[model samples]
Target chain A: MTNQSSWFETAVADLVDPQDQRVWSIIVSLFGDMAQEPGAQISGGALTQIIEPMGIKPEAIRVALHRLRKDGWIESDRIGRVSRHVLSEFGRTQSAAVTPRIYARDSAPVEHWHLLIAEDGTGTQVLEDVMLSDDYIPIGRNIAMRAGAAPLQAEGLLALDISPQTAPKWIQDRLCPPELRASCRALLTAVQNAAKTHPEEWTPTPLQSATLRTLLVHRWRRVVLRQPDLPAAFYPPDWVGPACRNSIIRMLDLLPRPSAAILSGSG
Target chain B: MTNQSSWFETAVADLVDPQDQRVWSIIVSLFGDMAQEPGAQISGGALTQIIEPMGIKPEAIRVALHRLRKDGWIESDRIGRVSRHVLSEFGRTQSAAVTPRIYARDSAPVEHWHLLIAEDGTGTQVLEDVMLSDDYIPIGRNIAMRAGAAPLQAEGLLALDISPQTAPKWIQDRLCPPELRASCRALLTAVQNAAKTHPEEWTPTPLQSATLRTLLVHRWRRVVLRQPDLPAAFYPPDWVGPACRNSIIRMLDLLPRPSAAILSGSG
Candidate 1:
């Protein structure tokens, strides 16, 4: 909260790249919480409730879960209609080891992101950002805000930082092992790049490259104009040209500044 | 474009406050090149081409516009089947004036906000916040890169800046007067706050002083959570609580960062 602008900057940075690391983050968070509550099967509403604050749509969650299952990292161990993540033995070992790709912690997973979907109880799909960051803080707190989770949910982002609210049970029991954070970071960044290059496209195993990021940036520029805050001139060099500049600038001058926050984990 | 988090924050803000002003920001941007076209009238695909990037759910836009027309500020001057802004005496006054609310544009206007009805577009619907920062940068450019009226489009935001791009006559022509800017700031803030407090229940004139800002923040909080970089715990004090903290925080922690920048805008 204190270092908001910088925090905001990084949070936004994750968005500029392509990939779907954030979706994994949501999945990890889901499993983590599920692991903690004994006899507690994470219900449909519970998942929906948690994601409400985050911009992530419900549809995205289902897709991510399916993708995770396909990747062999997670499986469904269902008791009736309720769902529980069944991490494969390999998944468990990796959760402890921290693969250089997506970090898989069974507890205290981040679900700070949420999006509104026009789907069923599972919720509609949200943006699936699968990029990884080189740092855990970036992976944890920054992107969490983008999902709309409250500030409290994002505190876990800093490994060595003191959490005013997180309890001993959650932290001590759920830590993903700091060593594996690096691999997760790399994985996050890679997936992020891939998603950007293909906005309408989806791929669980993305290359996560710079080429993808440029395309994402281009996409964002388009977003600004459609938003109509300014004219073509205000838009980044990539999105506009002279003939139209005449009418666009008038709109840019009209918008006001914006503020946002994200909360996760049962809120 | 470089500041995606900020841009998204703005979008989140608008979504949260889907009142006339914020909603108009969403819609006018949807108007796309048409809104920026000075005298041009907008139609179907053109609207979609411009709007999809802004992420304005077409449904939301319809709801808001329907409500705006019911209120008053907007009425249509029918050239044919599709109506154009009669550009009311109020419309012309608003559109031509340095600032739109040249008269008593305050609580009274807000009270009458709902008066702007959807009746055949016969009257000028006071466009609260039509046009976005991004609207004119590209389409009207005839697809030109450097030569389109990019400068015109970027106006106050770009043209008047220290390093002005090549000036666009149109951009310069549309510059909002200084006084109007101040009024806009205040009006926008008031409208923004009201929209936040009132979400789906929004109207041009919300009787509840509880203000729409409250719900707007909550709804937007939903979107904020989607980012992977942000942790679930990283939310503002207003949103954190027994409600969303845990799930959001845990989820964010599990996600990856530097995901894809799926959408963006001047906001």
Candidate 2:
């Protein structure tokens, strides 16, 4: 392999998450990033070409596809001898739900925030229901917060629309845990380093671009989706969420989104 | 008794709190209302003359005075044949703390209010401490609210400075229970009825004026002090707090505070 090709391989190794390698999740990220638009489809060969170089075997990709099909997240079709996959209606809805937050360059710093507090023990289930269905972040056993001016319809809970003043250590820790902070910091560092070493004059071929984009979107999806979208006050003192987000956006901008034609090798 | 004297007697009976006639607490209310100034004293005979018409025997008055002395609330002085009682410094301090709220002609609406929520179960103790020391009204097991913009220095508790938008039934009931509302409504009705029948031209003797003042203060104190001082939203829909306060103030205005010299029989 040429030096440039070796650098590309090393970059992929550095970018992919070491802790989570669920192939099904990786394929979901792939579809969410590239083929989320209606009628967008990826040929079977193109899917292998994009994901296999991340050290996943073709059989692993097939198994992940089988699982995705079984879960009703993707539908498969055959034209002549080539099989292609498209996001199912369920998959499209799920992807659309988070697409704005994941792809937003700058989220409109959640203007209005409210809190919901349950009674100590018996109200635990009520607060849990609000947290799960209403996008509330639980700050304590009986306390949860969400971004909105409108009060939640929690019957036994006290709701307060608040402008957050000071977030202490425990609240910061609860909202952004140590592990999440570390993951964000790790991603920021990797993306920054990759950007630094990337050659300025080089133009990647379609296959090369596909490989890089897959790795970038896969890692970013893990970090971005895991983060609680909140105002700056909610993050820990040393959280690198903003830096990681900026770095992820800058890196994705560098690797322009390849058209399905280019990714399918028909350009 | 003449017609006017009979009217005075009936008015005194109507004004005294039917539920609570604790003589010691009545004396506290008298001192807090008419003699809160430092060096203020009430002659023992005058104290009896004022409270005796509330149907409490002089021996009961002596027993209540004994209890008050034992509780560090009052001190006694004797010079030859006359005895006098004065609120102890501790008693004065305790009485002064709630006097303004109890006697104010109009309570300035609580503009800023805040809620503090502790973690369920384990955090009950923290919230309890805040409620005991601060002016927090406990609305739920883990939730308490207080008036002010100042954030409480309660660690591990989620504090939100909220301008109440809406308060539901449970919170309203928690802050102003049925018993409190009934007490307020009863006081309002009694004071309104007394105000209607009071003879404007009748000039009361100093002792009669003292008796009227003591009865009004005693009943009003029971209602006012029992209330959790919170914003209007916290009260029940049928709450008569404002009406009771208005009636009490009007009644108290009619029964002007007698001079200490009159109360001491030395005017």
Candidate 3:
């Protein structure tokens, strides 16, 4: 490979998440970023060209595609001599649900927050139910929080409308675990490093841009989706979520979304 | 006894707490109200004159005095034919602690309140310690609240400085139990009834005034001390604490505290 190709490959490796490289999840991120539009399809060769450089084997990609098809996330079609893949309706819906949060330049500010406390023995199970269905963030064993006003009907729990003023160390650690903080910090450094050194005059073809976008999105999705969208006070003091978010958005803007025809027809 | 004596005696019986008349506790209230000043004393004859109108027998008073002395709450002096009683230093300190809460005509509005939540098992002990030492009021098994800003140091608890916007039924009921609400209502009605029927022109000697004051203070202490002083949101819809407090203070104003000189010298 040329020096230019090797430089791009090194950047992709540095940008990808060091902890998690689940082939199926990477594929979901790829499809979510590239072909999430209705009826959009990427040729099989283009998918391979985008993901193969991330040190993923074609056999692994095949296995992931098989799983995605079996799970109704992707559908495949053969036209002439080339095979094409597209996200199924279920996959598209799933991607649409989180795409806004993952890709938005700014996270929506959660205005009102409330706490629900369960009783010691029997009421914990009820609180578990609310946490599952509602967007409740579990801060402790018996306490759950959600963004919005207190629920009108809290049958067995003490629901309090609260605006947090101070969060002690234990609460901060519980909400933002050490591992999550590390992940965010690592991603922020990696993206900031990539942004700092990239050549200003470099304009790559659609396939190159697609490959970079996939790695960036894949790494960010793993980190961003693990934690809930909570108030800033919920994060640990050393947390780098805001910086990571800014870097991710800025990098994605640098590498604009490539069209399916350009991605498939070139290689 | 004359008809006038019988009338006053019946009125005293009507005003006293029907649920409880623990003699030792009543004596404590009497000492706290009339003789809490350093070096103040109630002579034996005057004590009997003040409390016997509540229909307690002389032997019961002796037994209560025995218990109080044994418990280090009262010290007695025998000179010639009369015994005198004064609160011990420890008893004075204890009485001084809650006297302000009970006797204040106006309840201070709790402007800022916060909730401290402990972890399910281990942190609960720490929270219990804070509750015992601080002014924390337990609202649940692992939760405690107090007035003012959140503490600067909450090691293992989720300390949320909050201004309560709405309190549900369970919280109100938990903080103000049904029995307490009932007690306050009963006191409010009893005090109002006594005030309504009191003759405008009747005048009493120091012994009669002390008897009425002791009984009123005794009954009010039972009801007021059993419940925590909390914000209005914590009270039940029908709670009559404010009204009860008003009536008790008004009636106490009507029946002034008799001087120790008059109490000991008259009888």
Candidate 4:
């Protein structure tokens, strides 16, 4: 048990974001990963047990919860002497929107792609409006592309059905910038190290499982959601996106999600 | 014979360029249409006979010949006290390059087209360089397209093999601007009028055939060469490009090319 505890500490340390760690954002990630269902709620004690061990203070978690409640991302209720929190309706909608991308294991390469080109000065606003959807990626200031045929509402732009033939270094670099590549590589290494350093015959308690799942999903969400699912040709030579995705999926499968009842009870 | 002469005079007046009449450009058209072969020459008398009837003075023809000779478009030789002019080597090469486009009766619509997109700021120069070729049409400052698969030397741009599915009004307008559409319509009307006004039993002399052929080819060249052979969808609604091409072809068939020997001898 002591060995397993030590491994769990090490894994928590490995997954905590080294950059700016806003407690509210972390709480959002936690709720999005664990309690995203309509009525699913996490007790205040279970949230602390899952988050406080990541070097975050209990007071910081309380403040983040207050902020989330005020912003309508979370709702809190008191059951006698204990408190429980659940995602608000708006929050659940937002979480459900990106859940597919976060949990996608393997996406087939998109074959049919189209380009939307706007006129230089006046048509930029139309392209910008279209690019607000996640389906499109901006190729240039006036050009946006998507992995489908042209839409029927393409009134003010020139839309063409395109098959990508050759992607140059500039575009590859633009799509998968160096920082994204580095983030993917770092997450890949972190997950691999976490997997490798596990103690033999180790089993995590319900709280420990919830903690690891939240951390892994949080860090992986930050990486996966930052990039669109471009074809392999658009990725730079050193981009490890696919490998990182595989490692993340492997790690998530290893740490199956714990029920909210078990997590709150253990705490 | 007098009636034929009056008809010929009226035809010449109708065919004269309402815009600038640079005699050098007209001569280029004449040589390109009638005497493009190596060692084929037009005697100075024949040139005068073809050009002087268009209200241009003999001295203006002399000055234009001097300019053509200085610009390396025509080389002159003294043949038994009569001057003869043939296309210079450089001029013949330049004229030969555009002959296929000018004389093409019908071009099979290009099915395969590709786009080359450049990075926003710095890659504009690369796209501009590629746009210097006649094969490409500029869609924007950073985008150029051609009617084929991606080339082997696509160094600095993103190349896409595109099947154009829709072209908006702006693109159609850009490809066939208002001025070009007006020119096409005007030439179509002119040719139809010329074809309508021909009297019965009109057999043009060799010199008259050369003159009428020169006028028709020259006028059509100005219109056809200004626009690339884009797909039919790219042309504006009122663009008469195909109809104008058919009229020009029909007129040329009616006025068969006269032999150089007969033309010069008639002069």
Candidate 5:
């Protein structure tokens, strides 16, 4: 029990945000990773127990829940003095949209890509509108690219099927900026250190498992969702995106998700 | 003999430039069409006979020849008081460079093409330097295209193997501008009218054939050399490039090239 407790504390410390932590965003990531299914709910006590290890106060969690509820991202019900929270339909839809990208394993590299070029001045708006989707990556003010063959019709734009042979440093840096690279490298180290501290003889309690999983998914969600999935040619030489993903997957496998009934039980 | 003389007079009148005639350019065209081969020379008398029918004066021809000599495009030699002119090595090289595009019949459409894109501001010069070659067509300030696979190396530029599927009006207009389209349309009309005047009963003298071939090649060279040979999609709907090429080819077939020896002989 002492070994498990020490390991859990060390893992939580390694994963917590050293910068300003947005409690509302952490809650969204927690629910998205844990209780995303229909009719699944987390009691207010369980939410606090899972999040308090990350150094968030109970009042902060309450305020964030209020904000999330007002913003239509969460809903709550009170039954016999016990409050329970569930993801709203709007929240589930938004989470579902990004869930695949956030949790996706190393997928096959996208084989085909096409470019959309707008006219220099006035046509930029047309391409800008199309770039609102996550699929499009802006190469320049008037140029955007997407994976797959060119559409049969791209109005007011010049569409070309492109096989990107090489890219310059500016392009690689633009796709994976300095801040993103730093975050990915930091997370990789954190996950690697946490994995090494796990003692094989000790298994975590349901609440402990839930707490570790929340921290792992919360930090990783921020990193993985900020960058697009591009071919290896587009990444800088020192980019650790693949290594970061491997460490993250390995850590998540070690900390299996705990069921909601056991997590909410009053021990 | 009377019928042939009348037909030659009408042909010269139909082919003379209504706009300002660049005499030096016309001389270049004349040599490129009739005496581009090594050791081939046109006597002074033959030059006068072939060019005078186009309404240029002998004094104007002499001045143009002097300018061409100063420009290193022509060399003059006097053998037993008979002056002769031949293309210099520099002039022949320049003429041979564009000869294929000037005289090409309907060729197979280029199936492969690539685009070179420069970074927005500073990289434009790199693409501009590449655009100096006739093979590249500048699509925009930062974009140039060529009809072949991408080079193995393009320093400081993004190289993409592109299959251009659809282009907007601005791209088409940039490739084949209004003036080029108008010139092609006008040449098409002229060639169609000239082809109708062929009389089966009459055969032209060598001087007549050389004069007609020079005028045809001169006008067509001014039109064809100014535009790159792009795929049909790059041209506007009103572009007469294919029709103009066909008409010019039919006219050239009707007027066979005269040998330099026969052309220089005094009738």
Candidate 6:
């Protein structure tokens, strides 16, 4: 049963070794006094109450119980609807010498990379969108070129929405900096600023820039990947040949921009 | 071999399953192709070359190769320095459709978190030290009256760095909120602002505001947790008591400023 789950969920399973160890430490620290009772069904609520002394994630107790059960060290059974978990003999043996150290995922904290948990508890943030900047463009183009695909084909591969025909004009005019005309990337700024104000509506502003088209094209990729493809009507009217958009994407990927830094503009 | 490597490295192993199916897609697709050529030695350069065509991590390639080997779908022989990984008949028979899809972890692009990675990738960010606010006295005094910790023990816990003999004045002056006293948390602002500017030299600018010591004594619980012992000098000269300080920390957590807005601040 465990192997099957591990096969499907390799990550959580893999973490069973380390994350499990930490989970066990917390569990044992709470129940050390109750160590002799083999089959005692400790209420999950009681587990949270135990950790009330420490300030951390509210759901960490539930997660600890779940991981414990997965590792065969604990067995949880429900009485009425209240879930109760108990340590197995193996768990008792394992928890003998653990010093209950806090296992935050940071090996060491660095100045540039902060591990932030939202104080608002909504853990949502902006790292969600895959950027379409000068830096990312060259990478998109080159990967496609290496895959023996032209610019448009590359865009499809990179999951960018832009077509090959219009891709070059977009890249040349906006994406690759130093060569970019300030007016070309104006649409991107407009889109980003607009996103801040209206969190839901995705349509571009009246500028009708490549960034807007790029988002639409990406949306189509999602549509294609999730819901099967639409018939050829998905193709544009008088669609030109050889994926013209790809050439532009290829040129963009050919750039040497560092992946992390933005090409221009401040937050 | 792949499983062994994965057991050691979570990021590499994570490239396998639901971390984002796109990662798995890349892994399986590239491995499937490479597995066909059993005699070819898969070098890091070759793997790098292949992934360059796709724009993913080298670790991802190693992980996929390991997974294939672990599942007995592939057999690998290491001769001198090169690893020759060959797919078994079962691998050929599995009719898996390898499409490009993002995995759970990689599903989100990582541009948003205000993570402070070292600029030179060396100096790490460690919290110099953490202490509760200046208003330790009044807060503890209030808790003292309520059904809180024992008066003696509570007093000790709140003492933090302050002495028991001088606790009351600190709490009354520095620790309590405006409704409790005449002042809001202005002293907190000054101390915190200084810490933010130079964490190494974190000293409260207003060290001698007559009531501050009383505030410190009262809020001792903020500086310390419940097990309170210490015969006296556990606190430094600037050591605010536990109760008031911990409360101040709690208050600070409430100010949820979103990481300087999604740092395209690479201007």
Candidate 2 Cα misplacement greater than 4 A, ranges: A119-132, A152-156, A265-267
Each prediction's whole-model lDDT (CA): 0.30, 0.79, 0.81, 0.84, 0.82, 0.31
Point out the higher-scoring one by lDDT: 1 or 5.
5
True contacts kept of each: 0.00, 0.36, 0.51, 0.85, 0.64, 0.00
Cα RMSDs, all models: 33.0, 2.1, 2.7, 2.1, 2.1, 40.3
lDDT of 1: 0.30
Clashing residue pairs in candidate 5 (N, C-alpha, C atoms within 3 angstroms)? none
lDDT of 3 at A189: 89
Clashing pairs in 2: none
Per-residue lDDT of A1-267 in model 1, one digit per residue for the tens?
334333323433543324443665555544432332223334444455444333557888788778877888676665666555555665555544432112211113233322111111111111112223212121111121122322232211211111121222212212222322332343344334322343332221111221122222223322222221222121232222222222222211221111111111222
Q: What is the DockQ of each candidate?
A: 0.01, 0.47, 0.49, 0.76, 0.69, 0.00
Per-residue accuracy of model 2 over A195-264 as CA lDDT, tens digit each: 8777777567666677777777777777778755776666677987777778778877867667888655
TM-score of chain A of 5: 0.94
lDDT of 5 by residue, B1-267 (tens): 587688778777777666657888888988998899988888888888888888889999999999999999999988787888999999999999999988899755565788888878878887888777646877766778888888877777777887666678888888888988888888777777766775667688777888888888888898888866676667788988878888877777877788767655533
CAPRI grade of model 1: incorrect
Candidate 5 stretches with Cα past 4 Å from truth are A133-135, A263-267, B132-135, B265-267
Residue range A1-267, candidate 6, lDDT tens digits:
543222222321221222123444456544433332555545665555434333325477677677777887877777675666767777766544331211111112111111111111111121112233311222111111111112322211211111121122222222233312222233233333333343232232211222222222222222222211111222233332113223323322322221111111110
Residues B46-139, model 2: lDDT tens digits: 8989889889999999999999999999999888878888889999999999878888888755758887867667778988987888778876
Interface RMSDs of the predictions, in order, are 22.7, 2.8, 2.7, 1.3, 1.4, 31.3
Worst 10 residues of 4 chain A by lDDT: A258-267
True contacts kept of 3: 0.51
Candidate 1 predicts chain B with a TM-score of 0.25
